[model samples]
Target: MAVTILGMDIGGTNLRSGFVNDRFELSEFRISSSQAICGEKAPENIAAYIERLMAETGIRPDAISIGFPSTLDKARKRLLSTPNLEGLDDMNMVERLENALHIPVYIDRDVNLLFLCDCHANHLTADVIIGCYVGTGFGNVIAIGGEILVGKNGVAAELGHIPVRGLTLDCPCGNVGCVEMIASGKALKTLQETWYPEEAIGTLFTLHASDEPVRGFINDLALPIATEINILDPDEIILGGGVLQMDGFPKGALEDAIRLHARKPYPEQALRFHYSGEKQENGVIGAAILAFRHMKREKGQPV
Candidate 1:
């Protein structure tokens, strides 16, 4: 019988969970508010949610995988920090969930899971892939030989937090000058409210994409991406997230800005860029895939 995995994606605002088979088919999808399920006690709430899911679906998963929007330990066993979700820092999430469910539980940065799913769905065969997602905040992940590149500190590829000159707004990460403060969906909303107060946030790009302020915003968004391309010389760069999927998002303009900042000579000319549209269920589906891969690796089987 093919392995069935339970996957959960815990975001700052929403919670999504589902069951996926080894073949990557998803079912029993559910969505809820993150705060409603767990106002401050996220780990406990997640455990309870898993219990509820299993009861409702009547499926016993071989393993469980959760994607977290936070920094985790190098072992991917504990959350070190969750800037957006309170009371999640330093929690032993893996152990708690495993004990509750009597099955293996795997956890990793949410962006890493997204990258994995995109690679599988798109059939990307690159040796090295970089994923940059611009959503409520900026999310980034790097994969080498199909494995996420977790650095010694387990915080590698945090492209969004990279400091940029002249961007001094305070970020949720407690850092000033971070690119995310000026270039993410949150930033776009701020810009829209400030200059184009009459326009809806969703329509800013559509209505004023040609305006200088809007163009500058796009450049700010592309700078960190180009910087990563120059350093990694990745085989492929996949860009996605809510911001990229916004109405009338200037995809071509963003691409042009990236090429402008990317290193001259070879990488810029050879770089491959793939723009992925947002999928409501991708986070949960990717979590399931991670669970399957983790189980296979543990059993000395190919993933």
Candidate 2:
């Protein structure tokens, strides 16, 4: 029998779980809302939800991995902070889940998994890889030496929060004018409300190609992408997220901006893009890969 791996992706609004084999085929996957996990009991509720998912699937796995959209310490054992989800501050996530499940648990920021999936699937090996997800919000992950790069404080690779233009707006992380504030879902929403109160969020990009307001929003979104490109000229830069896949996004315009704003040389010429599907299973499969990697490391094998 093939060994199974269980994986989970914990988002602000939903929790997705699944089982996968060595080939990265997902099965018995499930998704459910996370609205009920509120307040002090939030951690326990998450644990309970995982248990229920495993029971429903009836496939016991030797290991489990979960991804969270939050800042982690270099060890990936605790959630240092989650701006969108307030309940997870200072939580010993790995220990709690491992104790409850009696199985090994692995965890990391969700965007890192996107990078891992892209690298593994593409069969590209590089000493440095940078993955950026551009959607309602920006997510960034960097990998080095075939392992997820964790900074000393575990809060490394937070490229989204880098400030730009000093534009003041409330950030979920309690800052103002963060890069996320200027170029995220919330930023787009604010721009729509202020400049084009009558337009829908989805239609901003559609109108942008012709309308001035729409164009402004697109420019804001591109600024940070350009900044990152100039700073880190990775062997590969993977771009995937809801925003990049949106109907009216000016891919040509964005790339133009990136090239114009980024420094000259091979870094500008070598830029590549990969857009994640709306139904992409990277969340679960990447989580499974994390567990598998951890198991290998525990056995004194290469990860």
Candidate 3:
């Protein structure tokens, strides 16, 4: 019998959920405000919402997989922090949700799930791939031999929090000097608010692509990619986020900045880039794929 999996993508702004079909497509898709689904960021509220969704859609799942915009613990059982969304920090979601739903729940970093989905969408065959997604926060994920790289502490590919030498901007991660402070959509929004309050948020890149501050933003965005390329020399790299998808954003300038900062001759020249999709269901689809892999493993099959 085919396995039934419920997949969810929990972000700062929205909660996307659906079931994955054989074609790697989403079925019975639904979207709701993150606050609505995880009211007050409570685990119990999240459990209740899932119950409501199942009741409304009449799609009882055999298993559940979720991608969260937060750091997962070594066991993938709880979120260590949700800098963008409050009250979810250090919460044991897997145990709680499983208890409520009476089914297995698998969880992972949102970027890891996104990386999984993007690779499948792009038909990538690389042995190593690194993904950097710059949305409300800077998210990084690495896969080697089809496995997500979780370090000793399960926080391995935390490229976003890698500190800048002299930056001291406060990060919601309870840390100062984090790279996300300067390289994410949050960074661009900060720039827009402080320096160009008259300009609209979506048009910051469109209107100020050449301004010194925006230029600095571009360079800051490239820092992690260049640094990763030099270190990992990954088979492929993916760069995506709300910032990159914005109209009039200088994709070329960002690429150029990456190349300039990356070491010459080898890693820089070998760079292969893949852009992540903008579909509404991409993250949920990714979560579904993640569930599929876990189901395979549970069935004593290879992933």
Best by TM-score: 1
Pick out the ten consecutive residues of candidate 2 with the lowest summed lDDT.
272-281
Please give each candidate's TM-score.
0.97, 0.93, 0.96
lDDT of 2 at 26: 89
lDDT of each: 0.87, 0.76, 0.87
Off by over 4 Å in 1: none
Which rank order by lDDT, best down to worst? 1, 3, 2
User: Global CA lDDT of candidate 1, please?
Assistant: 0.87
> 1-303 in candidate 2: lDDT tens per residue?
576888887776677778889888988777876566645776688778767777887777877888888888788899888777658888888898888878788888888776677777777677767777876678888777776667778887778888767577777878777888877777777787998788777887776576776666667777777777777677776777777777777878777767777777867888876555456577888888787787778889988
**lDDT digits (tens) for residues 59-125 of candidate 3:** 8888889988888888899889887776788889999888888988999988888888899989986
The CA lDDT at 268 in model 1 is 88
- Comparing 2 with 3 on TM-score, the higher-scoring candidate is 3
Q: After superposition, how far is residue 236 of candidate 1 from its true place, in Å?
A: 0.4
Greater-TM-score candidate between 1 and 3:
1
| Residue pairs in candidate 2 whose N, alpha carbon or C atoms collide under 3 angstroms | 73-154, 74-154, 136-185
